[model samples]
Target: MITAFLHGFLLALGLILPLGVQNVFIFNQGATQPRLIRAVPAVLTATLCDMLLILLAVLGVSLIVLQVVWLKTLLFGAGLVFLLYMGWSIWRSPAGVSQAERPEPFSPRKQIAFAASVSLLNPHAIMDTIGVIGTSSLQYDSPDKWVFTASCILVSFIWFVGLAVCGRLIGRFDGSGRWLLWINRLSAVIIWGVAAYMGWQLLASA
Candidate 1:
């Protein structure tokens, strides 16, 4: 049981530790929002999406879903387009604007929507969940399997909350928002890089 728990915890952490679009958006929200509570929608939505994906992956459902060629192509195409748009949006968002001129932060509804998009639309993230976590879960059985699944889910929840909290702390110190502007630009670049890679993969598969 201990081994299973550790395996799941480490595997999930390893997968999530990378600076992916989901993490970037969550951290951005935590920093830009007026208060941490305002970022809860994004945090909760992302965590729930991860939980759903992890559960589906461990249960073998996502593997079956990815087996469909056309469906997989469609996922890749949609992911590419959405990521490109999201990158542009983040890049253009008013981060370093003066306080009087700065636009309002993302509303709760917008936060949830964007969180879901980044979480669910990215085929690369889905494939990673299925390929890594799904295959890893096969090594366990019954109660151990459930234990492993729980451990993975727990890691995601804690990691996202911690990420947001850390972002909030950094935002508190950066009163002028100059740091936020750079962070947004960096996040956009990273997101576009991922999108380009996915597009290349989609073309290669054609």
Candidate 2:
């Protein structure tokens, strides 16, 4: 049990450590929002989404869903398009116009929806939770499997919350417009990079 739990934690941390689309958006929200509290909606939405996916994966649902070639292709295409759009938006956003300074704040509803999209649309995330976490669980017995699943779920919550907190800390020192502009620029690149990679994989599979 202990071995399975530790393995789950270590594996999950490794998978999530990369600066992916979901992490970037969460971190951006934390840095751009008026206060750290304002980023909670996105954080919660993302955590919950991961939780759901992880649960389904552990129960062997992903093995069935992933068999549909059409569905997988459609999801990858949609995810690619959305990533491109989001990347462009981040790159082109006005200067010195974070949520704190802008007259129009990003509503919680929109944030939650986008957070879900970011979590669900990305095939990479699904594969990690399902492909990696789910497959990993098959090696364990019932008790160990549940312990492993719980450990993985716990890591997701901890990582998301800690990421947001780190963003908030960075925001404190980056009062100048230069810092945010560069961050946005880098974020745009990372997002676009993911989109391109996903697109390539889709085409290759086709």
Candidate 3:
């Protein structure tokens, strides 16, 4: 159980350390929001989505889903399209929040929806959970498997909340629009970057 817990925690931490679209979005939101609490919805939503995926993967549902070639292909295509759209939207968002003309904070609904898209739609994230975490679980006994699953899920929450907290701290010095504007630009890049990678994989597999 100890070994399984350590393996799951370390592997999950590694897979999630990338500056991927989901992480970028969560960070940007935390930086942009007027209050730290405003960023909570996005953080929780993203964490929950990942938790669900990890759970499903550990339970072997991911393997079952992967058996459907056409369905997986269709999902990949849709995810790519969604990523493009999301990237464009972020790029077009207001550059900064000034006292005179503050940009509206993302509502709870919008935050959850976008977070879900970034978390659930990205083929890279899905595959990592399914491939790394799911495959690792196969080597564990029932007790160790549960411990591994719990530890992996725990890491997701820790990482997401930590990111939001870091962003909140950065927001203090970046009161100007410049920092946030650049963040949006970078966030857009991250989103499109993942989209491009997935697109290439799909093409290569074709």
Candidate 3 Cα deviation (angstroms), residue 44? 1.0
Model 3: how far residue 48 lies from native, Å:
1.0
The clash tally of candidate 3 reads 0
Worst 10 residues of 1 by lDDT: 95-104
lDDT of 2 at 160: 91
Write out the backbone clash pairs for model 2. none
- Give a tens-digit lDDT track for model 3, residues 1-206: 88988998998999999889899989888877889999999999999999999999999997799779987888789889999998898888776467544344678888998999989888778888898999989998889999999999999999999998887787758766677778778889988988999899889877
Candidate number with the higher lDDT (2 or 3): 3
lDDT score, residue 91, model 1?
Answer: 88
Which of the two, 2 or 3, has more TM-score? 3
Q: For model 1, what is the alpha-carbon lDDT of residue 12?
A: 96
Top candidate by lDDT: 1
TM-score of 2: 0.92
Off by over 4 Å in 1: none
Q: Global lDDT of each model?
A: 0.88, 0.85, 0.87
TM-score comparison, 1 vs 3, better candidate: 1
Q: Per-candidate TM vs. native?
A: 0.95, 0.92, 0.94
TM-score of 1: 0.95
Q: Model 2 over residues 102-158: C-alpha lDDT tens digits?
A: 322247997797789889999999988888899989899989999999999899899
Residue pairs in steric clash, candidate 3? none
Looking at model 1, the pairs that clash are: none
